[model samples]
Target chain A: MKTLKYITLFAAISTSLLFVQCKDDDDNVITQETCTDGIMNGEETGVDCGGPDCQPCGLVLDFSGTYIQEDQMGRPGINTVFGTEGFKDAFNVTVPSQMQAAFQEKFETKLLGLNPAYTSNALGLDASTFTTVLSNDVLWLAQSGVTTYFNGTEILTGRALSDDVIDVSLLLIFGGPMGDQNPGLTSDGVPTNDAAFSNSFPYLAGPF
Target chain B: MKKSKLFAVIGGIGLAVLSIFLISADHIDAPAVQGTTADITDFYAFQGQNTSNFVFIANVQGLLSPGQPTDEAVFDETVLLEFNIDYNNDLNEDLVIQAIKRGDSMYFFGPTAPAFSGEEGTKSTIATSTRRSVKISTRDDVQIAEQDGMKFFAGPREDPFFFDFNQYNAVLSGTASSFNNPGMDTFAGTNVLSVVVEFPKSMLPGGTTGVNQFAPSTPMYNVWVEAKRKQ
Candidate 1:
């Protein structure tokens, strides 16, 4: 019985190859079988169309199937700066659940290297603890409260459109206890967006 | 500033700029995605004007100067912009909102559960029953679509990220001690293609109250944005 099944499989393969050979030999001529075969062939831009015998195919946009992640940003500059040189790409695709475990040690190393002073930050997070927190890299926001990114009063409660994330990130990295260590390295001179944000829905300012 | 502190800052100028792999606020990225539409410039999650709603904004194709042809700076049809929400703090996206450009319109899918999640990416089937769309805004005029208490907009907008790239480079390379008090906004007058969505908090995993027992202390959700390309 097994031998019979194997022979049947071989016969099917041989038959398909024979058909393929015939189609290859028939180049310009569209055999009715080839046209209605439900395969893209013989000048068919799509499946068995846009060719001699078949009707022209229209553009079909299929928004389906799996996509590959090209870039991911949660907390600004986390991966760009903290992710070691060769591992930034890996960090981009790493799932947040595994980010801490996958990149925590490396993040810690980068953090200390960037600031060898090696102490707790404005958030009062020690070197190891701070890197662990940052390694997760997901932007945390609260449903309730004034939504602002790292305001002196509110911390990580969603970023407002006008939030100065760069300055905040700088302070946390260079600032020490009480958030006032390096007055210079802490805040970037550019404080706000060039244009004012809108008060209405879709609040980003219109293009220049 | 105190004289001694000023001196210290001045003295540190020569030692400040280190050759760190510094990129602006998620701009001018690594070679793989730097110039691609999949390059995510910034992700800003905030409260909407109507405090009842939460807004998620993802900006891409960063640093579009005024001189560049605006029409040429369009969203890529093959790129999928996905905002992932992790409600339970397990660091996995429990729900996602995806936006993609098709023809002249931009389609939005989900605020619903994801068909697939995590690093593997998703398909258009993830849209489920909840879907809304708007014509892609090509000019200064805003094109917005509102449906079922959700608002959607995709268009060119002033790049909201403010960074002094040159000064930052100097500081990193040990050439400058600190950033200037009024440093240049490298992104000034530039534009970014932004996808904005405003939806009621009730649409999220924990509903309007947003009290997730799993994460009682922090935000009900962990949000991150990713730009994925059709394979």
Candidate 2:
């Protein structure tokens, strides 16, 4: 009887030990990814930049803050007008390489639709060439020489801080052979910035 | 200001590529980030004050009222302010200048060779060669810095884009034929986060050749800005 009692106690201890050593399939410990994983699986809107493991997507990326691109502006007003009301997200996110092929046809149709009497604008560019230029969606800078969005002789070279770009753009789109087709449409007449541009390095006027 | 007349336009994304890149002045158009920290209001490239330098100004997070704090009115960290240069007229970015904000400082990565290019950008982080942690100010105080022939400033500025959207809309809807002269300043009384940098013309590689070659006949250099996020 004593021998049997000792054997039973050993069996019980052995069973307890086996239970303690058993593999834990139910114990789930997830190894979280560091911010450099290049995967958006984490709380990131982008890879490693956004979520609880990293920074918030709304902050700027330079400071280790998370930011998803919200907006982009190349040449002013091009995307605003030429792009369809539904094309903003694609227009804003598109790389310039694909912009022309993707949007040129739409831009052409819209240009003619807006200016039905379209022949050649003041720039002498037909609707096709003009929209071709517009569709690429870039701001061309003259670099070494005189830079203005359009100072009559040069068209779309680049923009000066005080350049009346909206007026120039309006004229290019609406102004006909004489450079004055539609009297009222050609100028927004908000000719200059509300404040004088700084004559120094950063040029933009102070914020109100 | 007629908030109701504001263009109720939301953008569409055709390709949801994993890579990262963003740009263009599509104000109040993007449903995801319009008038928020991610909004890109304007981009300007002109001769710098020194004349030998070229300046690139990219403004974002538009339409803030005056006296707004940076905590509330500021640049979002996720967006990379990139200045893409296509000197050869091919429209491919031969060089890129990337600026990002951290705390009070703004760091610039490169005007160097881009690791990956195009709409699907490889999210490469080049170690910063230039950084400006200047004191940011609103109205009177102007913060500026210089390094390796490059000048930098990042802060709040006046909204420079002026348009008569109401008239443009009228014409679009066939309610009117043309815009009225001195019609209206729709963007009046708004502020934007501005990042201005001036770098030596020599830093720009020759379009036909490569970096620092000033080809006299090359005449035109196409410039565009992008706001990219790391993917």
Candidate 3:
């Protein structure tokens, strides 16, 4: 019986040791797996667990809408030229020859620093007709000449020019006349235009 | 013997608990973005001069590479893209134009413009159209081509956004000292999901006239867009 008692006590002690060893190993495994709250120096390193600690991906509210005056009543504003019917089909006058040279000369001299190799050859319109085409087709520029293109087709024809502002503004907005005096390009190598240029007429909408 | 049996039970229990904990930990370590969410990179609403209608574009699936074709295939079919219109001074949705995509095609639900302002789902459908099979080309009207008497286009197209994410990231992380001379565009060669919708100016809450007499009377109307996940 004494021998039996000894055996029982030994077995109990061994089992207790095994339990303690298992507990330590379990703890070590947990420490190895989740060693840092799954965070590194307060930085999240684990998948979002749908809890307060986990940050689920979401749709960020982007409220960057730019409001422009819309045409209203019988007395629509000059800016409302596009909404008016028969605006596009109206007779499109060619730009005057003398004005083309002056405009091109001025643009080349004043804006060439913005766009290198700024030649009129690439411009779809000749010097004499460029202004009229721009005034009629371009939405952002203030209309100085006869405004006619209200139809989407004429506007669509000028979509490339309208979209080209992304490039033009890059040069002119920063280094040319409108850019910040601080000599540096935007992260994309485009010169940073002055803040005022961004606020200037016809705020070109962007996520560009 | 009883004492030994009790100790063995405790050890077994301890082991079982540890195993469960480790399993849970493994699951928590996986790094995959969740579904049922929409990431809108850009929203554009403007009057189309070429037409009497206004244009609405929702750009998604941002920062995609030309080689990442598989990721482009995962647009959720059940997700609904809705365009809300508020006609009056109240900041509520008055009209809704919803669109959904199926295998290689898109279906527009409504231009749901009512004689008076109200919720969108309840409004009547004005027109319906479907786009051609999906490809890297421009296609026209997927559904409700004309709602409140306006045209629409729903399909895939190259992302129009251009941004230099690498430079931007460097700027944020304090690794880069300054932007480049002309700047670098990380998104120069990327693509995104695009949804374009056009409507008549008359359909909007603001009258068709070019004056400031419209409700929500700011020179620039405050508008944001979203794509809600289906339940």
DockQ score for model 3, please? 0.04
Q: Worst lDDT window (10 residues) for model 3 chain B? A: B22-31
Give candidate 3's TM-score. Answer: 0.40
Using all chains and alpha carbons, the TM-scores for the candidates as numbered come to 0.79, 0.74, 0.40
lDDT of 1 at A4: 57
What candidate 1 gets wrong by more than 4 Å, as runs, is A1-61, B1-20, B119-128, B207-219
TM-score of chain A of 3: 0.19
Tens digits of per-residue lDDT, candidate 1, B141-198, equal 6788887899999989888888887787676545677789988987888888999999
For all candidates, state DockQ relative to the true structure: 0.31, 0.23, 0.04
Which regions of candidate 3 deviate over 4 angstroms?
A1-208, B1-37, B49-51, B67-74, B113-149, B207-221
- State the TM-score for model 2: 0.74
Better of 2 and 3 by DockQ: 2
Candidate order by TM-score, highest to lowest? 1, 2, 3
Structure candidate 1, residue pairs in collision: B16-B174, B17-B172, B17-B173, B17-B174, B18-B172, B18-B173, B18-B174
Model 2: C-alpha RMSD to truth? 16.1
lDDT rank order: 1, 2, 3
